[model samples]
Target: MKSRSVIHVTGAMNMGGTERMLMTLLRMKPPWKSIFLTYGTGTGTFDQEIKDLDGEIRTIPNPGSLSDHFQLFRTVKPAAVHAHTLFQSGIPLAAARAAGVPIRIAHAHTTADPSDKKGRFIYEKLMRASIALSATDYRACSSAAGNYLFAGKSFEVMPNLFDPKQFKRPPEAEVLRLKLKYGWTDKLVLGSVGRLTKVKNHAFMLDMLSELHKQGIKAVLLVVGDGDQLKTLRRKAEELSVAELVTFTGAVEDPSIYYHLMDVFLMPSLFEGLGIAALEAQASLTPVLGSEALQPEADLGGGLLYKLPLEAGSAIWAEKAISVATDSHKGTSDPVAVPPEEVLKHYYQLYRWKGGGHEQKTADYII
Candidate 1:
C-alpha cells in the first residue's frame, strides 16, 4: 500500500512548542510519512530527530509568499497539508486549495501576537479572511488559539501532547548536580522555557528579578531557549542591574534537567495558546507563575498554576514567585498526563478522514 503523505508547515522545525509537539507525533511512526516545510533555514535543535524518524524537512526562503507556497504545494502533491502557524496561514492554505489538495489543515498555535512588527495586524486580518476561504479544517492547541484564528467557526482543540513520564521529577542528587554544574547553588532558582521573544514578555521577567533583589530575596533566573530578543533581554537585565543573577542557556534538547533545578517556574507572556513549559514545570513538581493573558486551560486544573495580570507589574509577580518557591506543599506528584500515543492516534485519524481515506476507530480519544 502506498503511504499517504502529510506535509507540515511551520516557522521552523525548532524546539518551539508546535515543533516539539509535531516531533512527538512523528515518534509514533504512523502509517503515513511526515514532511516538514519550514520558513527558517531548516536547521534546528530537532533536525537530527526528524531525520532519524525518516521525516523530510524542507525550507522556504520566503514564508507566506504565495508563489513559494504554490510551488511547494505543487511539488509535494501531498494528500494533506497540516500548517502549524500563527496568524499568517493564508498563503499556504490558498496554495493548498490551488493545488487541489483534499485536506488543508490550518493549525493555530498561539492566541497572542508575539511580534510588534509593522503591518502585522493588517496582514493577519487579510490572512484570517483568506484562511476562512481556503482551509478545509481548523485546529488549535487551545480554545484561545481557535477563537483567535477561527473565532465562531468550528475548530478542534488539539492538545499539545508529550511523554508525561519524561517530565517527572528526577532524583534529588541529579537535580543538585545539575544546579551545581550551572553554578546556581544555595539560591532560590526561578526558571522559564520558551523563545526569548517580546510576546513571551521575558523583559518583564528581568524586572521581576530586580524586584526580588530589592526585596532582598536571594534568587537566580535561568532562561531556556534563544531568539531575536536574547540580546535585548540581556541588555535589559544589565540595565536593571540583575545581569549576574540571570542565566540564558540558549535552546536545549531536553528541558527536564533544567525544570528539576527550578524552585518555581515563571511565564509572563502577553498571551499564549497553552503554556507547555508551565505544564512541564508542574510535572517536575515545580510551581508556575503565569500572566493573565495566558489561557486558563493552561492550568490543566492543577493547583500549582498561578495567573497574575500583566498590569499587576513585576513586583507583584516577584512576591508570588517568592511565595511559591518557599511553599513546600505546592508541587504535585501526579501531574496532568498527556499520553503521546493517544494524541498521535487522534491526529492520524483526523488526517485519514481529511484525506478521504479509511478512518480508524478512535472513539475513546478526547481533545
Candidate 2:
C-alpha cells in the first residue's frame, strides 16, 4: 500500500520563524509523509535535514502560475496541501482545490508585510478572495496573524511551539568558555536572533548599545542569523562607534546554546506574527525585552517578557534591558512549554478533517 503524504507549500526551508515551526512539526513525526514545495530554486539550510528524515523537497517557479501548481498537485496527489506563503497562499490552494485535494489549509505567519509596494493592496485583496473561495481551512500562528489574513472569517490559532528538551541550559563550564571566547566576560550581554533585516530592526539594537555606553554600562550585543542586511548593519555599528562591542555570529544550525550566554534577549521588531525567539529565550531562562508590536501570545507565562515601544527610543529601552537582566529572580523559572504530543495532535486533527461548513467551531478541530 502507498503511504499517505501531505504537501507543504512555502517560500523556502530557510532559518526563519515559519520555517522553524514547520521543522518542529516535521520532527514530531506526523502520521503522513511530508513533502515540501518551495518557491526558491536552490538548496536551503533545512534541505539536507528533510532528506535525512525521508522527506522530499521540490521547487516551484517564483510567482508560480496556477497551472504549474495544479499540475504539481495532480502529479503528487497529496492528501492535503498546506500553504504557508501568507496572502499568496491562495495561488497554490486554488490549484489544490482544482486538483481535487480534500484538505487545503492557508496558514498566516506574519501580522503585516513591511515591504509592500505600489498596487500590493489590490493584489492582496484578490488573493484573499481566492483563499476564501478555495481553502478548506485557515490557520495562523497568532490571533494577530489570523485577524490580518482571515478577517471576517473564523480561523484556528496554532501557537508556535518548540521542544524544550532541545534548549536545556548549558553546563557552567561551557557557558564560561563561550563567554571567554566571545569576550563577553564581566559585560552585560544583550542578544537577538533573527535574520538581519530592516523589519527586525537590528539597527535599533545598535542604538540601544550606544545608549548603554553613554550610561556607563559595559554592554555587548550578540547578533545571530545571516541575511542581506549584514554589511549594512556592520557599517551602522561602526558609524555608531560601537563596532567593537557587537558580535555578529551569522547563521547557526542550533541557537539553543547561545541562549545560555545571554544576560537578556532583545526583540525590537517593527512587527511580528509571533516571536519564536522570545519563546526560546524564556524556555532557556533568559529575560526578553521585546517590541510592543509583537503578539502578546508570544509570552510563555514565564514572567520574563518585557514589552517596550519603538517610540520610547533607545534610552528607555536600554534602562529596561538593564533592569530586567540584573533582576536576580527574573527568568529563574521555567517557561510553560506545551508537550510535543499536544502540538502534534492539532496538526493530525487538521489533516484528518473532511471539510463541511464554516459554521463549525474551530475548537471542534483544534486544541
Candidate 3:
C-alpha cells in the first residue's frame, strides 16, 4: 500500500511557536510522512526529528510573487497542504487547489494587529481573501483565533497541545542559575518564551517587569527568542530600570532549559490566538501569569489570566500587572494536564480515520 503524505508550509524553521508546534505534531505521528516548507534556511533544522521520522523538508519563497505559488503547488503534490500561519496559508492553498489536492487547511496561531476600524476591516478583508483563494478548512488554536481569523468562515478547534518529553528540565536552581548568571536566592524567576516581536508584545512584558520593580519586588525576566523588536525592548528595559533584571537569550530551538529555570512564566501579550509558549511553560510545570487572556483555550484548566489594555503605553499596562503580582495565587502555575502530542494524535485519528476528500468551505472561512 502507498503511504499518505502531508505537507506543512510555514514561515521558516527559525524556532517560532508555530514551527515548534508543527515539529511536535510531526514527532507524535510516526505514521504520517510529513514534509516541511520554510521561507528561510536553518542548519540542522528539525534535523533529527524530521530525519528520524523520515520526513522531507523543502524551502521556497513567495516574495508576494505569482511564480512562487506555482512553484509551491507543483513541488509537493501532497494529499493535504497544512499552512501553519496566515501569511503563508493562501500561497499553498492556491497552489493545492489549482493542483486539485483534496485538502488545503490553514492554521492561525499568531495574534493579529487590530487597532482601528479600518485595520479591522482590512483584517476581515484579508481573512475573506484567503478563504476565497485556496483554504479548504480552518483550524484555530482557540475559538478567539477562529473568530478573528475566520469571522464569516467556518473552522474547527484543535488546541495546540505540547509534548512534555521534548523539554529537558534544568537541574534545581544551581546549575541553570550559574549558567544564566542569575542568583537563585530571593528572586522570583519570571520568563516568557517567544519571538521578541510586536505581536508577542515583549514591550508590554517589559512594562510589567518595570511595575514589579517599583513595588519593591525582586523578580527576574528571562526571554527566549529574537526578532526586530529585541533592541527596542532591551532599551525600554534600561529606561524602566529593569535592564539589569532582563536577560534576552536570543533564539534557542529548545526552550525546555529556559522553561525549567523559570519559577513563573509570563505572557503579557496584547492579543493571542492561542499562547503555545504558555502551554510549554505548563508542560515545564512552572506557573504562568499574564496580563490578559491570550485565548479562552489558553485560559482553560491552567494558567492565570488578567485583563490588560491595548494601549501599549507602558504605564497603564504596568499598573495592571501589579494587581496580578500582589494576588499571584489567582493565577494557576501548575500547568494544564493536556498533552499536545495526544491532541495531534486525536486530530489525525479524527481526520484520517474519517477520510474526507476536501475541506470545501473551510478555505473561504477566515480569509
lDDT of each: 0.80, 0.85, 0.67
Better model by TM-score, 1 or 3? 1
Q: Write the per-residue lDDT of candidate 1 for residues 81-134, one digit (tens) a residue.
A: 888776667888898899887778999888866666998888878888888999
> If both were scored by lDDT, which would come out higher, candidate 1 or candidate 3?
1
Instruction: Say which candidate scores most in lDDT.
Output: 2
Worst 10 residues of 2 by lDDT: 358-367
Residues 195-261 of candidate 2 have per-residue lDDT tens digits of 8888899999999999998888999999989888999999999999999999999877678899889
Error of 3 at 28 (Å): 2.1
Error in Å for residue 179 of model 3: 7.3
Mark the 10 consecutive residues where model 1 has the least summed lDDT. Answer: 358-367
Q: After superposition, how far is residue 214 of candidate 3 from its true place, in Å?
A: 4.4
Order of quality (lDDT): 2, 1, 3
